[model samples]
Target: MELLAWGNTELDSSWSVTEKSNCSYIRIYHLTSGSICYSDTAMSCALDTEAVYILPSHAPFTMKPAPGTDTHCTWLHMNIYPVLVKELLSIPYTQKQALLFSLMRCIMEEAYPPAASLSHCAEIFIQDLYQMGCLEKPDPAFSPVLDYLCVHFSEDISISDTARQFGYTPEHFIRKFKKETGSTPYQFLTGYRMGKCCELLRKGYPVSSVCALTGYHDIKTFDRAFKKYHGRTASEYQKYFKKIYP
Candidate 1:
């Protein structure tokens, strides 16, 4: 499932893993006095008043609470952008921003309506993401960088080179880039690389060849990073997604 929308309304005294990874659903569960363990080998972190989690698509995981556990909380799921997540982390630790969570609720409410407007909800969500420091408008020069990245994702490009080409010092360019894109040049480049890697893998490219084509130094590192970001090794991901490529 695409995980279009989801949230918890009334608090559940306790709930177990009825189903997991059937949908890309991440949720917030408020625990009254006990903790809920979510995962067998994966690790999760608490977000706010409740423990928040993001379940990667197709990744197997489990959730169970301690005996007598009682909790009240809301859960949400979204197709999030990596840049947006980076923006949220860039905010001051003390800041409590619920832009993403709030947007999910609004989208869900309208998702089933006779005249649901998901695109409108997306536009509003982008605004919320910007307001919450979870997204930012790219600088005018950023388009060049984006264009270059699109064409040369397989090349090893550095921020310093990109900065020089744009007539800005590395420090200045890095700051302006982050201000506009909510991600450092390195982070954005990696995201681009990962995206291309996914496409190449799904197109039936050999793992080692994909590593070379994607500018990864070696297959080992590429495999590790692929699993880290996509929750599946390149081979496994390709096995599932490759047939879908036309």
Candidate 2:
């Protein structure tokens, strides 16, 4: 795991520029612009609107602003290795991926002010970030364990099964996983499932569907666990997100 830094810069008036990536990089650009051009191409896209674009590593790119233009945007640059990116894209793309990047961009923008620090907020954000992206390939043994939890998250997976897949004894696996992720396999799985349940409920999925999709054998068990982990009933959680996010 890497602690990446993020920041933004504003171009003065209108300008055209080119830059090189010292190492392979991936950039997510959130732009609000009247008009912009990339390289020699004229950008006829809508102006002064929200848009997102991806720039692959080491790709020479150019940007031009329309006359009398006033534009602003945030650029998130992750010095992602190719292997890591390939693994990240291995999973089916989901809106969660975009939201994860957006929140990260927000975090970098907000600068983690110490005065307003909140553990709950930090926990939720970090969990979402981990859930959104996959680790690079040839990762540590624990990396596969974590990835398995995420991909098979809807299944009733067990610590022993996770350990077996990684060719480690159950006891040894548990200790190493805890050391690396700061949570036991069971604890991590439960948290991951709970987070997915929240996402499903927010999308207005029915309780029965969320239960079935999240590997809960019964509605009673699902409701109980969801309430226990989130401190609210499923219905209450859905309503809460609607009000907060809408």
Predicted model with the maximum lDDT: 2
Model 1 sits at a Cα RMSD from the real structure of: 10.2
What tens digits encode model 2's per-residue C-alpha lDDT throughout 1-246? 111223454655545645432223344455544555555232323323344454433334556665666766655444332122211112232465456545644554653422122223333433444565533233375566677778998887877877887898999988877566545566566766776776677568988999999989999999998887655788777776563333
Error of 2 at 45 (Å): 52
**Could you tell me how far off, in angstroms, the CA of residue 45 lies in candidate 1 after the best superposition?**
15
Model 1 pairs whose backbones collide: none
Total backbone clashes of model 2?
2
Whole-model lDDT, candidate 2?
0.54
Q: Candidate 2 vs. truth: CA RMSD?
A: 16.0
lDDT of 1 by residue, 19-75 (tens): 332222223233323455555344543333432333432244556664454544444
Superposed Cα deviation of residue 126, candidate 2 (Å): 7.3
The TM-score measured for candidate 1 stands at 0.49
